[model samples]
Target: MLQMLSSLLHHGSSVPENSPLPYTVKVSSRAKNARLKMTPHGGLVVVLPEGFNKKHLPALLQRHEAWIKQAAARIEVHRPEPLPLTENGLPYTIALHNSNEKWSVVYNNQGRRVLDVDDAGGRRLLLSADVADAELCRSQLLTWLKRQAHKHLIPSLGKLAAAQDFKYAEALVRLQHSRWGSCTSRQLITLNTKLLFLPDHLVRYIMIHELCHTVQMNHSKAFWALVSKHDPLWHTHNVEMKSAWKYVPAWVSAQS
Candidate 1:
């Protein structure tokens, strides 16, 4: 039974012996109590507090199987909507709605890579050859998006840091599926490249949230106070951030 439960947690159940139950276990050093969460991106995560016995996991999963199924079903009903494609859809161009930049994608038999970019002029660029495979096209376009984040996000973070009188050792832009951004004890900050899809204010809130962590690492009252001082509408922004994934086009999230 324990082995069956472990399989259910990792692989989700498909057969009667296992049941149609699925979950992921996360052991956190800071968690004080066992918890469960269901998000559109990371279907379900069972957070185990520090020092909690692993032996209790199977029973815990069994107890919550019904709730898990209901929650998963609810998620299926409200999945993020995919971005609409152009009239000529296949091998379509990728557009950054917030950044105001667009790249034309193409596929062919002879090309060095899945995507070969030709950018003679800044305004008009072409992704030449072998992009016919949907996955390859998505990968290449995501790469382009990362480049844009480095080009734009890094400088923007510097400006925000300076304006707020907050200092950080460095900044990194990455494609994070589960988080918007994070700041480490070393003062290194990582911003999600996906922020390019969100509105400016929401993006700024995430920056401010991480910068605040430089002084208060934990999400204690002091940390929140500091965050509010920097970004006044942080609460609203935080709530909005939960649903912001909807803004990301389906072609992109599918790759995630």
Candidate 2:
């Protein structure tokens, strides 16, 4: 297992943790260029390619300071407050969309140091760990969420495509925090795993939305007309999706 350590990296020695425009730097081997993105909970993230000097972050921040501030302000307005745990310090329930399977979380304080989950079609899951270790619980929940998405969302996409006579080259399910889903010109549809937390209607609408991209690559008038033909209530679904983050537990959403 990989050991996770948390630390801070400030562009300037005088900058404090309370700086209004504070940010985090993530070093990735796959990154060939520096990129900045505003996340729902992680705030501003500066992805730097490996072997890059950290000192240049100050200059880069200066260049995009205005954009960063505007984006941060926009995200803050829609950010949902983290869900509070019950008196027992456990999540109330773990629900899945478009699936009849049921699951429950049980934290084991004296057992092995790992979160164990049981996805027994409508069965309870036991998290064999202490309640105080919220991070471990969050990690386990995120893992379970991804599994649920694959089990439910992937197959549903195929069915939806066939029903609508929409052909796609491929589909991918991921834990993206920025957007719910996307499609490429190659007809590859990528969906966010968090969609499992949304309502059934919204989930179907999103699937239809992406499948429509297989025909209309852009969000032009024809693209929306296609989406409307499939999901007549696409407008309401789109508006409802804005508040879907409230369904996600703070622990998972905070990792964005």
lDDT for predicted candidate 1 compared with the true structure:
0.70
- What tens-digit string does per-residue lDDT give for candidate 1 at 92-198? 55566556676665455455554545776554335554544555555767787798888888898899999999999999998876578898899999988888877
For every candidate in turn, the CA RMSD to the true structure comes to 7.6, 7.6
TM-score for each of the candidates = 0.65, 0.63
lDDT of 2 by residue, 1-256 (tens): 0011111233422342434676777788999999887654445778899998977877888778788888777666655444456553457566564574446666667545665555456466777766676766667767777887888898999998998898999988888755778889998898888777767897898899888988888889998999999998999987766556655555555642
Candidate 2 residue pairs in clash (backbone atoms < 3 Å): 102-122, 106-127, 108-129
Candidate 2 stretches greater than 4 Å from native: 1-90, 119-122
Clashes of 1: 2
* Candidate 1, superposed: residue stretches over 4 Å from native: 1-91, 114-125
